[model samples]
Target: MEPVFRPPSEANSYLLPVTTGCSHNDCTYCAMYLAKRFRVRPEKEVLEDLAMAKATLGDVRRVFLLDGDAFVLSARKLLRILAAVRETFPGLQRVGAYINAANVAAKTDDELRDIADAGLTIGYLGLESGDPETVTRIRKGASVDEMVEAVRRAQAAGIRMSVMSLLGMGGREHSLRHARATAAALNRMQPRFAAFLTVTPVEGTVLHEELDEGRFELITPEESLRELREIVLHLELAGSIFRANHASNYLPLKGRFPGDRERLLETIDAALDGRISLKPEYLRGL
Candidate 1:
């Protein structure tokens, strides 16, 4: 199995593959799992992996389930997997997984709570763009409203959500709208962690084809910064930690909501005005 794709913060965590590929793999901008089919590893295989990890690493603090959208597993199966992991690794502290909104909606609130109680603590969700039009164009597979409700329910069930949004997902045409709408959605979801990454159109993705055909226009670097500023200015999150330091981002930014909001905007302004140097295009990556 391919190494689990995870956030920077999860670098030290053990990657346990619960599912292979993404359940919703039609997102136009995504190329992460295009070459693979989505499928859940059987419970026996999951437990075997956990046992192997336990034998190799005596102590494990964090475990991240992979490859993508492992939360799509049924409540019972997830619970069994969580129980096995906890049993195999007595020192386990947190179990995290990628969660798709549709999969989240499939679970009852009680099921979510049960999974959380069983040691699954956090869920990473990709909300590439919150503008309804952009979401539709990208084939994200769920409406903005559906995603909001899904995250809300998961949070209510004690699962801390780490939400991610891509800055240039809407292209030049809907940049401002995407930023504002995304801020609004984040305010409603109030995720524990919110990340911003610049869009990177991979060669085989629909987004790349659209760009090639002149159907979509990529946002300029300055416009991407402006969109970030618009989002920071409008975000009314309670305590969400914001990050824009992805390698794909032209500028790195990190701050807490409301409290460090002004500072974040200032940084963007400095970058926009040439007061601070932006990351060279050569150093940027997806």
Candidate 2:
């Protein structure tokens, strides 16, 4: 793949791979950064890339700080990259990154605040499951409390936050608890958004090994939909935008629930009942 570039804050932003790989890629399910060992791009190299991006792209409204766990970059390194991003992209207004809880934990409140003050508006995380057993089973590397703390600490630092949740993370065994605990955790921080990504086991990931050995059961399409159904029903979001539009999901749904939890749940169920075939699993990123 070619070197990717984007300002610190781009929504639907392109990629700026300051790091080549994920620091903690032990999550059994993901393959996005498995092929490369983790390392930060030299600051000079990152600056040069930013310079090139500035020369080419002019319109910039959203940017997602690329790589799996950009926040894992050293606080000083992150500051420089952010400063470079701001300086290079005159049009940049929104900046976000895909962050993991552990990475976020590495920063002090002051450091996080400084980054946010530098114009990094959003930070995204994957709180895959809130249940301890489920989290351990997948080696997600953060406990429920730790996940909540990550969210709280991020929020405290003045950064708007969004997190992803895997609907069938616990599979059939602990689905309900996963949903309830996850919802409970989200309720604590109630970040700017809650994006739902269905847990689809990709080939060549630890998750597949579990699936192959029958240690884990991939939920049926109907079961996955029902889990989402139960989740949205019980969620007590203040007014978070709930999105189930990721292609891996059983249903594509999106809307704002202004404290109308029941209505949101109903919406999910209705969509499930109405769809004829949510598409073949393979065609659907199955």
Model 2 whole-model lDDT (C-alpha atoms): 0.77
Among residues 3 or more apart in sequence or in different chains, the pairs in candidate 2 whose N, CA or C atoms overlap within 3 Å are 9-63, 9-94, 9-95, 10-62, 10-63, 11-62, 11-63, 281-286
Report the C-alpha lDDT of model 1 over 76-177, residue by residue, as the tens digit.
Answer: 999988988888888899999999899899999999999999999899999988899999999999999999998999999999999999998889989999
Candidate 1 total steric clashes: 0
TM-score of 1: 0.98
Q: Which stretches of candidate 1 lie over 4 Å from their true place?
A: none
Whole-model lDDT, model 1: 0.91
Model 1: per-residue Cα lDDT at residue 264: 95
Colliding residue pairs in candidate 1: none
TM-scores for every predicted model: 0.98, 0.91
Per-residue C-alpha lDDT of model 2 across residues 77-103, encoded as one tens digit per residue: 888888878877777786787777888
Q: After aligning candidate 2 to the native by TM-score, how far in Å is the CA of 170 from where it should be?
A: 0.6
Residue 60's lDDT within candidate 1 is: 96
Q: Rate the local accuracy (lDDT) of all candidates.
A: 0.91, 0.77
Please tell me which predicted candidate would have the highest lDDT against the true structure. 1
